[model samples]
Target: MSHVSRSAAVPPDDLSGPLTLDDLENRADKAYARHMETYTAVTVLHRVHMDHAVWNDTASDTLGLAREMVTAYRDVTRKEWYEAYIAWATAAGFEIPADMVNDGTDIPTGAADDPPDHPVY
Candidate 1:
């Protein structure tokens, strides 16, 4: 199992205190960056699992399950990231821009392309 430590990615201390528009904007940027970083990492890991499964017959089930988990986690992370941004914006008394919100209705759920017979490991 691979672990990614995020202990150093702590939020800025100014969030608990008086915040200017600039502070709010900076927070939003950091949140977005973190979300993107997670998304990219998950995507890479999922691809790795899928590729390994395709090439190695013995570990297909395990890798498939791992890929499925990564997919689900990616979806949840995407949703939670958006929610966190909205919460931060609300706390900062800033209006959430319409483009920033993705309710996931229009996005692919990542499971649609999975093979039907692969059992979870």
Candidate 2:
């Protein structure tokens, strides 16, 4: 996995003046990349900890704690990035159509007449 780092400079939160959409998009993109990098690192640490259980338990526990800390950092970074994107989009007057729905599935609108094949439980 590729290494990701957060930018030293973040976009100012002051929305008192006009801001370009392109600039906002660029900031959001950078934030997203940083978040992904942290997330990948945390996942890798977790896998390593689980796979090397034969090693000293004390070392493994320390690594597990590190993974948990990084996971929390990744979650916060992701949320901040999402909020920035939404704020910029709203400031630019980008609106979602009333007819559109986001169900986190690839199924097209009005195309799935039956429920999913698998049970929720």
Candidate 3:
């Protein structure tokens, strides 16, 4: 990985100059995080805000699974960070997708799955 959590999501402090093999792994980890974040964001948009029932429900079903499946690679902190970020962004007037739409049944444990990974990467 890109030494992401190892250095709290960044290259090591010692590597201040050009990119070398020593920092390659860290860079890769950073790339992984970036891609994963982008993917989750898109999936959220389509799977939540967009009407999935209009389609065959196959894509939405798969996207739902993908959303939960990718969380395995992230640490606990990263997972909480993402959730908090969503709330913050929404409060900041940024349109964000909810986990569920038109559903008012709030189960206390709805979001209590094993989010040990960033989102289950």
Candidate 4:
């Protein structure tokens, strides 16, 4: 596999404006999209590094972390990342209730082309 550096793909830390965790959370889809792009690049880089045995022939956390992150990326790729977030959060002991997010809103059947937006992403 070919590898590419992330310098060109990632936005500059100071690009457009100052960065904040909240800002990132607010742009979840955009952030996830960029993350997946850069992650693909970095994974290629790591595979190359492993091919060259740059890590001293010892297994490291990088591979596991990459797998976990990819799982997370797939979870967030859903149209309702925020809904999943709320569910996960509640299961994790947060106080968010489903009604607070879903609000009994009706979605037309067979509306795959227009999935409802996740309110809490």
Q: What lDDT does each candidate get?
A: 0.53, 0.57, 0.43, 0.44
lDDT of 2 by residue, 1-121 (tens): 1121222232456855445666666767787677667756765676676667488878878887887787678667766666556655554556733323335443122322223322333
Worst 10 residues of 2 by lDDT: 1-10
CA displacement after TM-score superposition, residue 75 of candidate 4 (Å): 2.0
Best by TM-score: 2
lDDT of 4 by residue, 1-121 (tens): 1132222232224467643333433455554355445445445545655576455424456655665666465444533444434433433345654444554553112233223222122
lDDT of model 4 at position 25: 38
Clash pairs detected, candidate 1 = none
Rank ordering of all candidates by lDDT, starting from the highest: 2, 1, 4, 3
TM-score of every model versus the real structure: 0.44, 0.58, 0.27, 0.26
**CA shift at 34, candidate 1, in angstroms?**
5.6
Model 1 residue 3 lDDT?
31
As a TM-score, model 4 comes out at 0.26
What is the model-wide C-alpha lDDT for candidate 1?
A: 0.53
Off by over 4 Å in 4: 1-32, 35-42, 45-49, 54-59, 79-121
Q: Where does model 2 exceed 4 Å of error?
A: 1-12, 15-18, 50-53, 96-121
